[model samples]
Target: MKLAIIGAGMIVKDYLTMVSDIPEIKLNAIVGVEQDVPTMQELSEKYGIKKVFTNYEECLKQADIDTVYVALPNFLHYAYAKKALESGKNVICEKPFTLKLSEMRELKKLALDKNLILVEAITNQYLTNYKELKESLKKIGDIKLIECNYSQYSHRYDAFKEGKILPVFDPKKGGGALMDINIYNIHFIVGILGKPKSVKYMANIERGIDTSGMLILDYGNTKVVCIGSKDTSAKIQTTIQGNAGSVIVNGPTNVLSDFDINLNNGFSKHVDDKINDHRMYEEFKKFNELVADHDMDFVKKELDHSESVMEIVDMALRDADIQLG
Candidate 1:
């Protein structure tokens, strides 16, 4: 797939770092706004990107690229992905797919009508360790409770305290604890357990945004509490509790480093099923397959999961009275 990358953000560099592993993906162009040309050109020269484009629309008009990777800030995802689909190219969008559910729905419709693959680049869903953890759920019996914590005090927090708002802390930019970090825990739950009965969000609001927060997801038989914070840091751990036993995942949910299983029957095991060194590799590999093969069935399934996630996000924001589009 010849690809046009729309941003020179940190995530774009992450993708470039592991580009060699997936021979199916090819870097065709690096695109950004005129003001970002310097960064884009630097990225182009470094990654051997053949074309540099300041105007995304003009670049999309060309026939050289078949796919666009929208790794821009959270607020730009909808507009950028929409334009990419309108250009008749598949899109690999970074997650939190959109700040609102309606936007995600529109993007999903656009991709389907265009008959192009549209997939969110959420790390957990495609991780080898995550898949194994899901498969091991049966051994843990019926899930009764789940607690997922993904909290990292951003270096940006010090600046935030000084009344400086970066995109990661700006509400207008779709930044906050739940949307930024907790969304992975949201994906971890929604991707595995599907939609919950309902959701409630309790946030530590500072300067009109959630600096830290706890999201509760009820699944009728199971209840989940996900804690995400940008103002604090802790030893990240996720536990899936059941009548039979429990599974504990240590470290970041995004990385899924390794996990442990403890059964009531005195059975315990440690699992390390990582497929690659780069946390982003596994998902992009799936993106390559889906886009190259035109796997609409798989794409639709992913969209379904994405929609469910957006629904929860919508409710969570509503509960906190955090109005965002």
Candidate 2:
């Protein structure tokens, strides 16, 4: 994949760290703000990328680039990704997909129409442990309750407290517990439970944004409780309880390190077989193959899953009486 990355943020830095492990992903170009040019140059020298453009349009015109990675702030995802797809470049958009289901629908339609691969860069769905967890669900028999907690008191919250608003706390930028950290929980649950029959969100609102929240997903057959908070700290855990057994997952859903399966009959097992140390590796590995094969069928299948998650997000936002500006 001849890639053009459009952000010089922390995520991009992390990608560069393990990018060499995925040799097929060629770092063709990087585009960012002029203010970040120095950092961009630093990255270019380190990654051996030849093209660096402060102007995204110029980078988008690079004939050698095959895919665009939209790693920008939440608000820019829609516009940047749409431009990439319109330019006939496949896109791997960082998660939260979009702020609205309408935006997601339009982007999916555009990608399909253009015969381009558009994928949400959600980590949990692509983790080998996550895949294993899915298969392990059967051993647990009938699932009755699900609970997920992904919370870390953000360093950015201190800036917000001092009246210095950063993107993570900015309502208009689509930052909140739900979009920023909670969506991973959403993906982890929705990916397994499918779309809940109904959803409700009750959040701790501050500055017109949800700093922390509990999302209740009513699946007629089972109930799921998803908790994501940026204003508090806790040991993160995801538990799936079934009549016969239970599955326990520790750590962030994004990088599912390992899981334990405990059955009612005293069958206990630990699973740690993983593809790579970096969380993004598995996703990009699968993404590269999907892109290489031009697998529209598989792409659309994942797109549909992303769409369902977005729909629940939209519903949660509405029911919470919160709107992204």
Candidate 3:
């Protein structure tokens, strides 16, 4: 898939680091605002991206690419993805998909109408370890509880504490613990359990945003607590408990790195099956393959899953009375 990347942010840098490893993907161009021209130029030179455009419209009209990766901030996702889809390009947007479920619905409808692939760039659902974990669930018997914690004190938290508001901590920009960090836990759980029976979010709010939060999802037979924080740190771990056994994840939900499954009948083992060190690698690789093959069926399946996740996000935000763009 010939791809035009639409950000010069950290996510773009991470993607640049691993783009070479994915043979099916070609970095045709990089697009950023005029202020980020230098970064774009440096990235383009280093990654061998053939062109760089400061304007999205110019890139859409001029770049020789079939796909656009919307790696911008959360609030920009809908507008940018919509533009790309309207330009007749397949779109791969960063998580949270959009700030609102209604926006997500519009993008979904647009993509389906155009017969173009549009997917949310969530890592866990595409990871090898995540897949293995899903398969190993039966070994643990009926799932009774799940706890996923993905908390790291943000580098910008100190600045925000000092009253310096950046996009990440700015509620108007869709920045908060629930959307930024907890959504991974949401995807990890929802991918396995589909939609929950009900959802609620409890948040630690500061300056009109959620600095940290606990999202509770009720799945009838199973109970889930997803802890996501940007205001504090933790030894990030996730666990799936059942009647006979439990599976413990070694790391956070985003990087489903390694896990241990221990059962009551004296069977236990460690599993580590991730194909790449970078969490974004597997998802982008899958995106490339799907777009290349024009596999709309699989793409639609993922879109449906993403829609469910977005629905839960909206519910969680409403439950907490936290408003975000």
Better of 1 and 2 by TM-score: 2
Error of 2 at 123 (Å): 0.9
Residue pairs clashing, model 1: none
174-218 per-residue lDDT for model 2 (tens digits):
999999998999999888889999999999998889999999999
Compute the lDDT for candidate 3: 0.94
Please name the candidate that would achieve the greatest lDDT relative to the true structure.
3
- TM-score for each predicted model, relative to the true structure: 0.97, 0.99, 0.99
- Better TM-score candidate (1, 3): 3
Model 2 lowest lDDT segment of ten: 55-64
Model 3 earns a TM-score of 0.99
Candidate 1, superposed: residue stretches over 4 Å from native: none
The better-scoring model by lDDT among 2 and 3 is: 3
